[model samples]
Structure formats: C-alpha cells, structure tokens
Target chain A: MEWQNELTRLVKTSYPIVQAPMLGVTTPAMVAAISNAGGLGSLPVGGLSPDQTRSLILQTKALTTKPFAVNLFAHQNSPVNTAQADQMLQFLKKLCAQHQINYPKPDLNSIIFHSYEEQIDILLEENIPVVSFTFGILNKEVIHAFKEKGTVLIGTATYLAEATLLEQNGIDCITAQGMEAGGHRGTFLDSKTLPLIGSFSLIPLVAENCQVPVLAAGGIYNGKTIKAAFTLGAKGVQLGSAFISSNESLAIESYKKSIHDAAETDSVLTKTFSGRWARGIQNKFMMEVENSGLAIPDYPIQNALTTPLRVLAQKQNNKDFTTLWAGQSASKAESKPAGEIFQKLIKETESLP
Target chain B: MEWQNELTRLVKTSYPIVQAPMLGVTTPAMVAAISNAGGLGSLPVGGLSPDQTRSLILQTKALTTKPFAVNLFAHQNSPVNTAQADQMLQFLKKLCAQHQINYPKPDLNSIIFHSYEEQIDILLEENIPVVSFTFGILNKEVIHAFKEKGTVLIGTATYLAEATLLEQNGIDCITAQGMEAGGHRGTFLDSKTLPLIGSFSLIPLVAENCQVPVLAAGGIYNGKTIKAAFTLGAKGVQLGSAFISSNESLAIESYKKSIHDAAETDSVLTKTFSGRWARGIQNKFMMEVENSGLAIPDYPIQNALTTPLRVLAQKQNNKDFTTLWAGQSASKAESKPAGEIFQKLIKETESLP
Candidate 1:
C-alpha cells in the first residue's frame, strides 16, 4: 500500500490495480466484479453508440456501487478512401475465399464510427467518476467539460512524449501503455512509426519525467509485475489480456482458450486486423493478411471490415481466423473469477519479500 | 541496498548495477571506473583476438581491483553465401555512390570475426570472475568449463523462452535485454524475426519464470530505473547507452553529443548497420539503408562493410554517417564521469521515498 497513496486517493480504490478496458472482451460484469473487489474496473465505451454506452455504464453501476471508469477512443476519423476501401474489400474477398466464406462489401452507411462528443455527453449526463481515453488526446473543451464534473481523466501514452503532452493537457493520470499491450497501441504521435518500448523501460522514464501519476499497462498479469510497476514509480497498474480469460469477461470460449493456451512468445504485433498496430496471438488471418502485404483501411473501417470473419470464426470456434488479442505475457493468464484474480494479485503483491 | 544482497554476494559488488559491455563504446577506463564505484563493469571482448582480449582485461585489472565481467558473442558462424554477399555488396555500392566514397570489396579472408573457444581459454587463464554472453547460448561443455573455473555465467535473452533455455543450460545469471535497448539484440532464436518487446513487460516475465537470477538491461539510465529493475525482480541491471556519454567511455565527442541531444523517441531499431536488429539514433545511413529495401548480409559482414564510412564520419563529426547506437531513453544520459553517474544513480534511488 506504500505506492497507493496518491493514486488510491485519486481513484478511491483500495488497490491501485485498474482492469484495462478491453473492447469486445471486458463485460459489465467484469467491470463491476473488479470494482467490487476494490480494484478499479473500466467499461469499454469506445466505438459504442451513445445509448449503448449509457446502458452499459448503468448496467455496470447496477452491478457495483463501487467506483469504476468508463473508457473511450478519441482518435480522429480519417476520411474513407473509396479506392483503398475497394482494394481492402478485394483483399478480404481473397481471405474469405481461403476460408470458403462470402466477403461482404463495404456498407457506406456504416462508415461513420461512434461520435466521441456524444459519448462525452453521455458520460457527463451519468456523472461518471472516472474516464480513460486512448488513440488521441481529447480537445480542451471536452477536457474542461470532464474536469467540471470532477472526473478523474486518464489518458494512454505509448511514449514519454505522449505522457508529457498528457500532463500538459491537464490529464489527471497517464497510462504508460507499452508496445506489448493487447488490442490497439495507444500511440498518438507519428502513428506509423513503431516506438515498441517495453514496460520495464517505458514505465520508469514516463514516471520520472511526467508530473502526473503513472498507471503502468501492458504485459502486467500478476502480483510480481504489479509490485514491479509500483517500484518503477507507477501509481497504479492497468491489466488487459490477463483478465480476458476470467469468468467475468465476456470473451468467447475460444478467445479465452486461445489466451490460456498461448506461449510466452506467441503474441505478435500486426496492423492487418485494425489498420493500427495491436499485439495478439498470431493466427491464420493475421498471418495471411500480413503475408499479402495489402494496405487496409484505417481504424473503425478496418475494425468493421474484419467483424464478420471474427464473428463467424468465433461461432465456429476457429481460432485461426479470429483475432486473439493478447499481450506478450498471455501465458501467465489464469481462468478464474475476476474477483478471485484481483484478490490473488493483492496477496501476491503483499507477499513480495 | 535492499535489492543488492543476492546479486552483490554473487558478483562481489557493493551495488547491483552492471555496466553493459558495449562494443565500440566501453573502454578500459570506463570499465575500471564503474568497478571502482562498486558496480560491476563488463569488458566487451566479443569478436576480439585472444591476445587483444587478454590485453584489455589486464588493463582493466591494472586499473581496478574489484571483480569485473568479460562479455563474448556466442553466435554460430555460418558459412558466407557468395551470391547473397555479392547482392549485399552491390547494394552498399549504390549507397557509397551517393556518399561519393570508393566502395571496398569484401576481404574474404577477414570473414571469420573471432574464435569464442580461444576467447574462453584466455578468460580461464586470466581467472576472470564473471563472463556474460549474447547472440546465442553456449554449449553445455563450454558452460560447464566456465562453471568449473568459478566464472559466474550470464546470458542474454530477449524473451522468456530464451531465459528458460539459458537456465536449462545452467546459466548462473540471465540479463533480460528488452527491445528498447540499444546495440544488437541478443536474441538467438528465429534471428530474422524482431521480438521488439519493451523492458517493462520482458523483465517481470523473465524474473518470475526463470529459476536463475535475472539482470534487467535496456533503456535503464539512472537510479530510478535501477530501482525499477529491482522492483521487476531483477537481481542486477546492465546499462549500455546510459554510460555512452560518460567521460570514461570510449565513444567519440560527436557520438556522446548525439546521445546527449537525443529525445525519448529519437532512437530506432534498425538492421541496416549490422544486419542485426539494434536500437540507435536515426541517422542518414540507417534511414537510407532502410528505405532502399535491399537485402543486407548477416552481422559482422554488414558491420565490417560500414566500418570505413563510420570511421570517416566519426572523424568528421558527422552523425549522419556514423552508427549512433542508443536506447529509446537516450535523452536521460548526462555527460559526467562514469563513477559520478553511478553515484548519482545511487543517490536518486536512495532519495526515493
């Protein structure tokens, strides 16, 4: 608890562990479970409609009166290129052909992703205590609005520069998301270039330089790692893939199994799945798409494009085609109740000699 | 001091910090200075003749009475591929044409870098207390010989799998080199694939899983980072670029200046200079070579091929041509005596509440 004073006071949590907001994986039950266990659980509100976001947040609230965070994506939406979109669809057609599935053409109507402003409005309306963001920095007005509501604003940073920017922008906390994290990289600068610094190195640099409290994320799965983070000057630690296999997680059985069966070196970073770098257990879909070297559309577009394949693959329990988002240390994950996992983390950290 | 007991007892150092053996950077003075300051200094004897290696070790011993380590590359020497070598030479020719320098043909007889067997014999004769290796694991017979001689064996691993392999092979210590580290990656597994995992993630995984004691390396610059490594369960820390700017280091004034001028995101991982993945400051040579997409020869060959240009560039103080090896956190390095830097690290760590 020596490392918990500042962060614990800010988040009002017994433990400084923050369950990462993993899209399509973290459920309301998982969020509530982690919060109820005295750790902060974050509901992934990114890419969800305003109404959907509100309902999910409310559901999480109903499950636990304890404080929790709502996560959102603040990425700038790039205009869809028709030509690139067509090429991407054609590439997917070839991928579908290999799997003997039909490739769906781009739905022009579905091009627009969820509006961040609308999500903010919903968060404000519900008076959410904490709000974490990824992809990019929120505008000043948005940040001001959140600050007005006394929201504990957390931002994700892949490099020290991003952490400095977050501190300058009045962010309450910064999550130093190392390159080994699951799902999309939270890098906001020079997005094409891979910074790819590991947590061991990144956390200390971010913690020492950035004035704001640091939340170490990526490849953190157990109590030892949590203790390591606190030692590295992180006020808190955010875990993603480690919680994916928990009973409270909404991940498909196959997804959970994929995480469980993974080896330490199984995770690979690829842009094929979401047109943004993300670490995951390599599968046939990732391999083929990477091998083909086809340029895919940007995020939300690429994310939507691969939805069918992922869904169908999940239904058929075909891990080869599904995106198995996981951190490099997914091998350490245990299939247990999230509350039990939280307790185990606490016990392990406390037991460190 | 709390984290130093196990490592200090094993290595006979007052502190758990180990100065990394950086070829072309670490000098006898630097090694002795670190050892004199109670941190174990390592001599980079990799790819050196037995006579040259012995001279350097003797020089270091003459300067300092403290125990030190000698490092060697244990990579398997593959036969030169004439056709591939020719293609690589041609590609370099094009690069040289741009610089208006006369391209030198391969001295085929100079292909064999050094003999590790002979190097080991010299270490045994010198009664070196510590010997660390990189690139690949040594055979059991070699490891057994070192162990019999009371030489504490440390091996580098980029992944947990490599650490397991090192432990199974009876290594006494494991230096978990994260991807953010400068210099050539120590990965011996699938050499072609870049396992660019950060230190935050890599160290904890290696420390928790590996039975042998772990030494965390890469992107560690100061006392805070040293403390962070211990938190990650490292018995010690091996720092390379952190000492690059130290007065005792052999790095040129320009090279030291480059390290001092770099930002957190300035360093990049490239296989251009050595055809082996190493993190360094982005230079004209690296940028052009990467852009060319030309297949380069393996390490030692490509490293030798660029030596002349680098030498001339260094003499001219042109960072554009020289290989400015550095870590992602190179910006933290300060120009000072190695002993002062070491003391600063201890002071910073001690001051931490």
Candidate 2:
C-alpha cells in the first residue's frame, strides 16, 4: 500500500523505528528482539571480519525470520605508521600489566579490512532486506549491487552536506546525526565547518533540503524526543544508545545501570577512548586517556590498540580502561526486555500530540 | 492600533527592536540615536537619583521626543555591607597608592538606588510611557501604579518560572535573558536556581506560555539571529552586549575591542566580578575570579565591592581587572554610531521572511 508516509507503512513494523546497528553493542539477539517485535532490526558488522559478519547475519535470521539490515563501517582506514602503532601498543601493554595479564602481540588480524564487496555478496546471498553504511558514502557499484537485490540503501551522515551527497548517490534514506550521538562520529566532511547541528536545528534543515526521506538519529530515546523528531519531518527515528542496556544486548549489567544513572550532563565529546570523537558517560577510562599525553593513532589501529584494555576493563569492572560508547540519550537506555521497551516507546510516541 | 499575533506589534515600534539600556555603557545620546532610528531606545536610570533621572530624560527628550524607556534596577538599594565595602575600599586604596591618587570614598551616588517604586513615581509624574526593570522584579504595587497611568512595564526573567511569575503579576512584557547574556543575572526568584536558559530553547518555551509579548534578550546582534528569534516567536529583540561599542556607550576602547574579538567559545559564565553570575569575554579578571576562593556577597554589595577594582583597571589600561561584561554574541559587537547599529539591526530583522 502506498501510504501518505510510507516509511511507517512500507516497513511492516510494530513501531516506526530502527534498532540502530551499534557496532560492538548490537548483537544477533538484539536484532532478533527488535525485529520479532515488528520493527526493523539492524546488525552492526562494522568492526567485524567477513566470517563474523556472515555468522551474525545467519544467526539473526536463525532467531527471527523477519526482515533485518546489516550495517557496515564504509569509512576508509586512515593511514597508520608502523612506529606510531608500536608506541600505542606499548601504552596498551602497560595497562594489561595492571591486570597481571600477558600482553598479546599485535597481529594482521587486528588491522585486517573486511571488503564491503565481500560483505555485500554475503548479504545478497543471504537475502538481507536492508543494508546500512556509516562514516562515508557507499560507492555506486556497492549501492547498485544492493539495489539490484531490492535491498533498501540507508546511508548515514553526521551533517547535512553528507546527507546531500548520499541522496546524490541514489541512497534511499539519510540519517542526520547530531553532535550528541555517541560512538565514532560518522562525520568526515569537515567536522569543523558543520554548524554544531543540534537535533532541533539539523532535522528541520535536512528534511527541508533532501528529496529522499531523512531518518533522524542522535539523542532520541524518550517518546517525547521521538515524537518531536517526527514533528520535525523525520519519517523514522533510528536509535543507538537507547538499546545499550536492553535485555537482548550484550553489555555488562553495570553498564546498563550506569546509563540509567547518567543525566544529560554526563556525556561529553572526547577523543580519549578511540582517537575519534564520540559521546559517552564521563568515566575513569576517559580521565586516564585525557591525562596520558599521547598522539592517538588512527581509528582501526587505535581501535585495536585499546581492545585489550577494553576487554580487561569490562571483565574486571575497571571502568578506567573500558571503551564505553554511549549516545546522548544514554539515560533513556533500558535494561528491560527489548519488546517492552519498543512497546513503551511506541506508546509514548503515540501519546505526544 | 494594538498589534496581535506577534510579540513585536505589541511593542509599537516602527522597527521591532529595543536599544539595550546598558547601565554604565548607554548614554542619553545613544538612547536618542536608536529612538531617532525608528526603534525603541532606552537608558538605565538606576544609577541616578530622581533629579538626575529627570535631567537625563529631558536631555534625551531634547535630542528626540520619540518613545524611550527608563531602565531601573528593581532591588531596594545597593546590597553593599559596610564591613565588606570597607575591605573592598582598603584593597582599592592600595591600588590607588600605585596610581599616585587618593582612593575615593564609597560614592554616596553609587550607593543611592532609585528604587523601582521611586523611579516609577518619577516617571509617572514626568509622564513617561515605558519603564523596564532588570536585576529583579518591581513590586506588583509599583507595576499596578504604572499600568494605571497607561505605562508599559517590562520585567526581566532568566527562566521560565520567572517569566510565568512575571505574567502572573501582570507584567506587560518580558525580556527572556538566556545564559549568553552579559551583566548581572536577573535573580528575581532565587540566586542559586538561576537558569542558564539558552535563547534557542528559551524564547519558544516562554512565548508558548506567555500571554504578554515576549522579547528575546540575549546574545543577539546580527540579522540572522534576529530573524531566528522572531521565527522562534519573539515580538521584539533586545541587544545589550552588542551596544557596548556604540558611539554613545561608556566602555573603553579595549573593553569594546575585547567583545569584537571574542568567538562563540570565548564567553564564560563567572561569578568573578560581581557575586552573581555574568557571561563575559574571559580575561584576567575572569582568571582571578575563577581562582579566588572568596565567598562573594549578594547583588549590589558584591557589585559595590568590585567597583574600585573595575574602575581602577580601566583607568590603568589593565584589561585584566575590569568587569568587562558581554554575552556570547560578543563577536558581533561592532564599533559604530548608535544610529547605524540600530539601522543595521532593523534592516536585518525586516529582511527575514
């Protein structure tokens, strides 16, 4: 049925929402819970290998025969110097010593790039109904590949210009991320030039300019904000931080409790965690990163350099070394079952006039 | 002849603008310039006695008989405690020694506040049409006295609750002072609960509930922000900090330059100069205020205490010590004739659709 607002109608869903494919946070079970509840679920395959990405897609389908999207970090790995990577690894080794754990050698597996071409082949064969890319534009070849298979192409942008670029490339929908959203700022088109586009300002701007529908992302957790986004002309709202503590997600219980306790003041943009600006709860790890006068290596290498620290920190409850990625709407993250959260969010959205 | 549907029309100006009645900065000449330019010009008579207030008003009337408002501090009198005032005087006496001049005694003039009630009485007898009060709210008794005389009473509120309270008390209009505004915060309700209401969020919230016309009074200087404020539901826009450099203002050249050179990141809210929080271009005075562990007294007492330091700092060309008050829109403050500034603002406001 061609409805007035087909995003709400075209996607058969209990709610006009997408469970954001938050890499390292979005699990197979998390995708299942949101999809099974009749909303589109997204599995983040951004930081994973081809085998891992294939397993997640297959496992998500295993749990729910319902439609789901596979997300990829389409951003290029920035050039990392061999000498700089060693210094970053050395700093990590000292942190590993704090936990009395043996330092592991940096291997090719850590810096390995999973081709979007290969990931596309898997999704195409697996018949994934949706595919989303973040951090950069999906090239014409890859976008065309997905379109040939009837897959919905959702390209993410952190600014209006990127969204314009996405629409220019025949992308289906655009996601305008405000500064408050946590994790890697999927913005590379001169973050300095973009007006600190708060959701209140950015959504109206993008919606007014773009021909394709814009899905508002960043800081939308409560039903009030969700309704406000829709009122600003968003067809659908994609949520990331709100799903951090869901029962189906893989975060530690303390992480969930931390999000619950955080207020609007708790989040700040710092390059301390992963060398890229992301919003998260101000933690001891963030403090240490600030204090350690080190020129942070590039993203994926920096991502690998801090892996041991994050893993050990999460396991030992030493929050100082943990890579705690959270969005501006961290306070709205729930530890309840995803189904209840979805129902409640939809109910709240409907409640707002 | 009363205009409805917009806060601007209620203001009854050819151009929907108000000349910021800056306390020390604005002179009769500047007020007349804005008035002559088809905008409402204003001067702070709070610093003057009833006789002096009448003289200034008449002086401005000689320049232009058009509508102009007399702004008054709404408190009872200067809150300067004798002991604290003595201590501040002693500190200034030492600086006076360095300057080879005798330290002036607490000017009885500075201590003498023409109470809003007393000021309104003067204005009423003089047949003044508009009166605006800041620093606090004028009493309902006084508000009624002016309203009976067909005078418009404008109250300054730093938060939503204060705005609601102002309207409840029959205030004819309100100045929505956001966190970006310079000068003493209008702590009509409570000092500690002073809200840093940014203009983007504040104007609409106040306008949505306010029956009286809403005037957005914060970091607004240029046409873009003026248009934004109107679009956000303001009737008239007020510019205090932006007027610091006008030909009729009292600021030193360096003081005006400080504002002109400021970036959006340059402003900081500090309780350094006066005890109450005020945003300004951060300087050495701000550094001292940040470092000083002294518990500043309330309102005019703290204002009186710092008067010596500010005055001395300006005379000695020591930019560090002066209480250089400005808002987040300091970058837009320009050195020009008052008429040109008013004309520019009005032209910009009219340019908006």
The numbered model that scores best in TM-score is 1
Candidate 1: docking tier: medium
DockQ of each: 0.58, 0.07
**Candidate 1 lDDT over residue span A1-353, tens digit each:** 56457888999998888999998889999999999999999999888898899899889989999999999998988888778877777888787987787656657556668768779888998889999999999999999999988999999999888888999999999999887788889988883366777776688888879888899998788777787678777889999888888998767887788888877567887788788888888888887887887787888788878877777777777788778889877767788999998899899888877
What TM-score would chain A of each candidate receive against the reference chain A?
0.96, 0.93
Q: Write the residue-wise lDDT of candidate 2 on B165-283 in tens digits.
A: 88998888999876657777775666333455445446666777798888888757776566556656678888888789888888988888887876544566677666667766678
| lDDT (Cα) of model 2 | 0.72
Ten contiguous residues minimizing lDDT sum, candidate 1 chain B: B191-200
State candidate 1's TM-score.
0.94
Runs in model 2 deviating more than 4 A are: A1-4, A9-14, A98-105, A108-110, A191-195, B1-353
**TM-score of every candidate relative to the true structure:** 0.94, 0.60
Shift of residue A292 alpha carbon in model 1, Å: 1.9
Off by over 4 Å in 1: A102-106, B90-97, B100-106, B109-112
Least accurate 10 contiguous residues by lDDT in model 1 chain A? A103-112
